[model samples]
Target: MRPAPAVVAMGVAGCGKSAVGEALAAVLGAAFVEGDRLHPPENVARMARGEPLTDALREGWLDAIGQRIAVSVASGQGVVAACSALKRSYRERLRGFCKDIVFLYLEIDPATAKQRVGSRPGHFMPASLVDSQFATLEAPAADERALTLDATRPVGDIVASAVSLLGEANS
Candidate 1:
């Protein structure tokens, strides 16, 4: 068996992070955590109003997610967390807390992402914010250990590819 990874499904909103993360967790038999649930009410409100969150507003939320990763690592459990870790700094924060973490970035085009976000209902993140997400996204090209998957692919393919990446990394 391959070693378990502390996995993070990262991308802009509407890239299916939560869905893919959940499926990946089930396949890996690891805990699935939706990073959005850790967001403070203020952050949610800011996004709801189509306002992009400043780094200051995001610090607490990032810390909360990092702490979750730390706890999961300390317990010797693999965790799959879905977060919009849009910047290198944010990813660094997560890595600081979990040493065995592997990031899977869902790469989706702006049009497709906008469509997905627009179609979804009851989500606090407005479609208008997606542009900001893309603008803020600093992809991890330097990090060769990170897996970049096409979010345009079928969900099954995405999950399978992620599993394969995790398998290879842990082997």
Candidate 2:
């Protein structure tokens, strides 16, 4: 049997990772995992206070997300995860769980990201961290199996494009 499919919808804060990931998962009939929910309380608290998370603080969170991906792969079920996998190393850590995992990069300008994040309410991540997110980001290189999309596009359009592309590859 074929291995389960996995897709990580990744970007800086305010890039609509959660919204896009959830919609893509629904279209593909896969489970959606909000990476933020896996963050340790301290991490969430720090972010809520408008502080950026250090790499040390994020290590455990990344491991937790990787563990969830491992479980889904073991269960032979697909999963779509929304994470600000801002660095190549972070994506590499997730790839340790499933080498074939696809990454959907929501490419957006800092202004747009800040605007989107600022408009959201009741969210832990603040607009103050937008610059930090972009600062840490390392876009996937040409060799990586990543899809880059303009995050300013509509959610439905993004998901539809993802479904069409991933369907051909995953099928």
Indicate which candidate wins on lDDT.
2
Task: Tell me each candidate's TM-score.
Answer: 0.95, 0.96
lDDT of 2 by residue, 18-60 (tens): 9999998888788889999999999999999988988888889
Q: Score candidate 2 by TM-score against the native.
A: 0.96
Q: Which RMSD does model 1 reach against the true structure? A: 1.6
Which 10 consecutive positions of candidate 1 have the poorest summed lDDT? 1-10
RMSD of 2: 1.1
lDDT by candidate, in order shown:
0.88, 0.90
TM-score, candidate 1, is: 0.95
Task: Judge candidate 2 at residue 37 and give its lDDT.
Answer: 97
Model 1 residue runs over 4 Å out of place are 1-4
